[model samples]
Target: MTQEAHVTQGPLTTEAGAPVADNQNSETAGVGGPVLVQDQLLLEKLAHFNRERIPERVVHARGAGAYGTFTVTADVTPYTRAAFLSEAGKQTEVFLRFSTVAGNLGAADAVRDPRGFALKFYTEEGNYDLVGNNTPVFFIRDAIKFPDFIHTQKRDPYTGSTEPDNVWDFWSLSPESTHQVTWLFGDRGIPASYRHMDGFGSHTYQWNNAAGEVFWVKYHFKTDQGIKNLTAEEADVLAGQDPDSHQRDLREAIERGEFPSWTVGVQIMPAADAAAYRFNPFDLTKVWPHADYPVIEIGKLELNRNPRNIFAEVEQSIFSPAHFVPGIGPSPDKMLQGRLFAYGDAHRYRVGINADHLPVNRPHATEARTNSRDGFLYDGRHGGAKNYEPNSFGGPQQTGRPLWQPVDGLTGGTGNHPTPLHAEDNDFVQAGNLYRLMTEAEKERLIANLAGAISQVSRADIADRAIGNFANADADFGKRLEAAVRELRG
Candidate 1:
């Protein structure tokens, strides 16, 4: 039989699908001369590479994201008239991004760091984003010290490496970081995976409904995957084998239809009762105990779809606590207030001014209109309408009926002063409670992880300062870690 010549149709083409003249060389003055300016492809390629990296977030640079829906499991219409959570069994489209706060983009996923749990709810009202973290506490409560705190968590200026001495120095000086440091060194510090980890609205927020009723609230996204953890040795091995373990797991699980889910429960307190509470209700490093404010099941959230393109959808995705639909607002937690400003600013730096134009972040409600326009990558059609508001062109206007409550009456101090300190502000109670709840094996693993890591600090003073944090969490917790470090020191 004669073998027919199987001819492949064509040669490679440029982005415009035009036939390329040369694959090897750019248009140049001569064969071995400098490249010519007429080479559009060469210029385009180099220019694109130069702009490849948008600014990385000063924190939460490493992350994994997925598409999901939040289905309301209970009727909380009385507490929050927010459309997504009011109707029982209503499915609200959501995108969740799990992140490690202190690591860079290429850092290990299982490193002992607080994971960011941010959810963007695309609701009928608008886009409601609950920007939170895995742990219900933070190292600092005030916004003013955020830059300084992040500086310590990042690289040492001279060595350009993360130093325990630098981190501990900040913790020692700040004092407010003690509570969160305890949680960070606990078993939950390095979660087994994005699935096994729990998510929390670390700062208290507000939920209000019709009839002028307002309630202070916090959100908890409990992983139905069941909380699990890896030993320090196991995590180190995984990190070496796969730095992108969490990212791969989330994508593969969703692809196999083994969707990860979390039960959404909320702790609510009456607005009137907040002022009289024993602790600062707005403090980020504090949690409302279930005994005092039980978790009212509101819904379930599941991540079922992986991003089609990781960089466009997952990397570029942004969440802001300030992006609330009506009926939900921020609490006065100093950290939360700081985040409200920081989240958007970081997004602006990372994805540019037109980030809102990205599919993942753009508000779903078609009726949405704002004065925002014309920046670096302006894509809006310029509206071809009025640039400013208050025009008689029947432009978008704010509504009066579905009202927004003034926060002036919500927060009260002696005019412009801090609230009086409460006894519960000591910051040790919750940390101690968390320590006592740990299983003997879990406690053992936590102590071992701390001592093993802290032993590398080299400086005796730095190791001692870090070990002292455990002592505050529990006497036994500190003692074991100290003994281990002492042996290593010798």
Candidate 2:
């Protein structure tokens, strides 16, 4: 066999961009002696290799992202003075990520789990991140329960495997999980593809107009491709056959110019209505009824480009519900309040204090000049600027108007106080209403899915408790789930 000559395209270099002398061999003390620490190349390579990967996200670790554009289709200036939505035909760049909630970084993309639908909109004012999920409601309403709920989703420390009993026990104990559990067990839990599912800002957010009037809002990104789901059997088969099926599907579709899009709509309620609303609109576990407040079309989102580098653009990209521009702010939702602090802290630890300085995460239209100075990998753009506020020197001063001022006569003690409930705040009511609203086919599928999951729980008590939760939602839902579980177990 004839051997092709090796071609040297470029010289190997260290991370610092210094030319490498000998990448293949390490310096040693004489021939065949112990390797010397003087070998900078070997030391550098080993050290970097040891720390190559950053810590994966505690949840929604597995994800795919794309570059997109968000175009204002309707005038929302009366609702929000946000520059991005100030006029029709206005467009802003966006990065959207879709992920499975209960999966590790290497887990199958086709798993039957709630999908994340996070978007970062780079507008003229600033970047606004709408961190949300595919489902309209979350499992728990309180931030205090978030850690425990996530623990249940993860593997058991003792067994090093997923524990069905642990999951069922948590769900059963936390009745607020009933609504989300119903959604999860249904066919929609396993979306056919990321493009085929809707995205929702699960918590109520505050939007203020130029006149300082506030409106509570819920965002919905309805897929233009139409809603589609995979049955458990099909999802399981696809998981085995192609673990990265969803990621591949999105990428290939964009490459073929069949760009996926979503129509952006928001359900708005008057600020005064929140005080007398039938339910707590801020509760993450509940959904705003469409009949009460219909969706108002605002914009359209379309994914037109794939990421050039997944690691830099997708993996390092960060989005937070707290990252809001002028005219938009967080509501009094306990979960959203906690997330305002938690998401940024998590990103700082996982990436670095300078994670926001990365090209993908940097504010595209504005300069971020703050007292926050150097940490690891800071870009040194803070060069010679006064790192303190209230100085005479012309540093970046606060420019934008405040979204909203603090409410007057606020009195509250810092404790684990439950959010004051309304006359219709029973956890079971909405869940039951959801079940009653479903068609017979959907109801049957929901029962089968719930049974399949509950039957896997080793503890009979846990299984019974979970069934009781379903009963609390609706008698028929409970009865059917109980029968299905018995048949499956037998």
Candidate 3:
């Protein structure tokens, strides 16, 4: 049989932009035998198909993103000299990615998980990324335990599935997880949609003003759509019915012109205040009481456009808390400190060294002038320009100004040391306060939710240890949890 030479240009092309001769059928060995390896089209298609996916993030594997604008509403010059936040009414382009912390790329959307709220501001100075979560606190304060905590949330080595024993055992052993664990088992754990929940820059960060005066800041993005959540039963149904429920809702809402928005606010504390604060201000597992430092409205973030390609735009996009403009810098927050290095390093490995050169990640209003030269996917944007500094040839020179003020008074010896505790740094205090603040119905729901998970553990000791942390937070909380777990397990 003679294969017809159906050669025609109809806009279908290969990766090299060459027009494809045939896409429907492969060039086979006389139409019956094994396919010919010399068929370049078949080889190309197979190779590309095999390499289509990059490694999914160890955490936050499932995500959705959109392009948006952040409009400054309040003058914050006294707080920081970051160009994007320098003047009221100033606007900056932003890309926000919402994600589930523990689920895989193919996992259902409506699960009880901490949603990643990573925002990238394409500023005039450079890109500023505020990487955070839906909750104000996290399970553990230190980054050293991060891998262990995530491991428990992931698949068990023996069973190849997430095990209740692993999760409860870790949470039980780590007392610092009480506050965040309480938050996680509450009603807000499973958000109805990304737009319906609040986002928090969970770690404390430093903001230095033009005067070189420093302040600690925490960001909050209150959803304009208002807080809405799904019960475990409702979430299970939704997950089964529509696996991409949250992602679909976000895209459809923007398409209909119902742009999702959040009122951005910041809790600012004087640099001096952090030293003698009631609790460790830099602790990732605690929240600054609103009474002590009120949240001042700063701006509004509205997502108006969805990404055209999930892989090229959303998945390839990278963020790091270290990606800051002048006046903004890291705090002593242990987790935040660790993330400053881990995030960028992960992007470099997963997305390649030239990930920043991607359209979604490149600076919007300013050119990224760096000594960084060619690597994988290098676009040759430099175009034979001088890649070195201190050259007689007017290349980009340093402004002799650091992004943030230097820390003073370092007298401690370097070793594995726990952070010095403040006046009220007990891990359970805030958790207890949170539990007490909840209404009776809310507490009931929280206890039920916690019990449902805790009861799944095979060992009674692990259940007791997990319940004990909550008990330390509040006697009533522990008692109720104990009762609920017993009933459920029976």
Candidate 4:
């Protein structure tokens, strides 16, 4: 075969494929200082640049996803009355998304960041999404500071670079972030892959009963594949070699039938316990030490298949802590409250008004009937059915039958008062526990990790302030990290 290559000139086109003319330059005012307002191409380019990125997720943008199934393993109906977790051995389909916090969509997966572990359960009741993360602790305990916390993690708009000063400065000022900051510099911060890591419901949630009893609960999805991690050095090397390693691993494993599975376990506490507990249970930064509340095995989750399409199934899939089935509901964790409202708003902006209609986001078994219709990518055009409810005409009716547990009267007594700070509610305890649990080698690695990151902050005081967070976690851990950071500075 003879090959001939030539530049084929084509007609000029606009950003959306519309034909354009006069491509040389913008319509200029006398070929100098200013451009004419009539130049449509210039307007389009400027407008597009203004909105170059969809609002990046407040957190967990760098991620990978796969489809999975949750098979009921235990009889938990006596504990709570949720249909999906109703019958033992019954299976419901799920889609799981794993992601890195504090990074953009194109950022590296192994960036020494917490990984988001969000799961969507397509149940008979509705789509139940458990949006959690790899780490059980978060940097900030309150939701009010969430936006400011995220701002530090993101790029500095002025410089278009990640500024370490912004990070350490923010954390140091807000001592509440000390616990999560410690975890960020620890061993599990950079997971080897989505398959080899565990997931946690980080915030405590309320699981109510048919008899109107509310139980405080936290979920931990222990990976059957075993929790594995990459040291900072290993993670840095892997990031350069493969930025999409975790995403690829999840996809490949599911395709090969080496399905990754997790044991779904929950620690349930009676709502009354929140008052007398050693720590404030609603605090997102604290964990109920397993000794106080042991993990009870409830079910098995296995990701056996990957999404057939990335855009529709994986990318567009939205999981919010707000989305709960009957028996499950949100706790007063401030972040949880903000998210219950923010997630749906985010989906509206990024995916579209009708993103839920996408198969991955939609309830698989339970039909969605609503009066809303016709937005971008609208799949349901009301289907010739009356859009208005309360119409005498035959229309989809709200099921009067008893379904999911009601949220009324049950949570009324829970009250809106602040969670009283208890003895162990301070952020440093769990961070210290995680540090103490580390092996000597792991401890050394943690020190090295801290040194590596804190050294990048231009100001020495900022670097020292970050080390202060480690100190709060543990005196020795802080001292070791401080010494290491000093060595780097020297």
> lDDT of all the models against the reference?
0.82, 0.90, 0.93, 0.81
RMSD for all candidates, in order, please. Answer: 4.9, 3.9, 4.0, 6.8
What does candidate 2 score on TM? 0.95
Best-fitting candidate, measured by lDDT?
A: 3
Off by over 4 Å in 2: 1-10, 21-36, 412-414
Off by over 4 Å in 4: 1-58, 397-419
Q: 228 in model 4: Cα distance from truth in Å?
A: 1.5
Residue pairs clashing, model 4: none
- Model 1 spans with C-alpha error above 4 angstroms: 1-24, 29-34, 365-367, 401-404, 408-420, 458-465
- Where's the lowest-lDDT run of ten residues in candidate 4? 1-10
Using Cα atoms with residue i matched to residue i, what is each candidate's TM-score against the true structure?
A: 0.91, 0.95, 0.97, 0.85
Candidate 3 or 2, higher lDDT: 3
Whole-model alpha-carbon lDDT for candidate 3? 0.93
- Give residue 320's lDDT in candidate 1 (0 to 100): 86
Candidate 4 lDDT by residue in tens digits, 1-490: 2221221245667867877777778888795759889888989889988965555566777767887789888887766778898888999999888888888778877778888899899999888888899888788776778889889988898998889899889988877777776677777888888888889989888877677678889999999999888887788898999888888888888777898999999999987787789998888888888999999998999988776666666667888777777887877788788888888888888878888888788899898878898877786657778789788888777766343343343343665555459876776787788889989988898788878878888987877777887798799998988888888888
**Cα RMSD, model 2:** 3.9
Q: Is candidate 2 or candidate 4 better by TM-score?
A: 2
The lDDT of model 2 is 0.90
Candidate 3 similarity to native, TM-score: 0.97
For candidate 4, give the lDDT of residue 122. 94
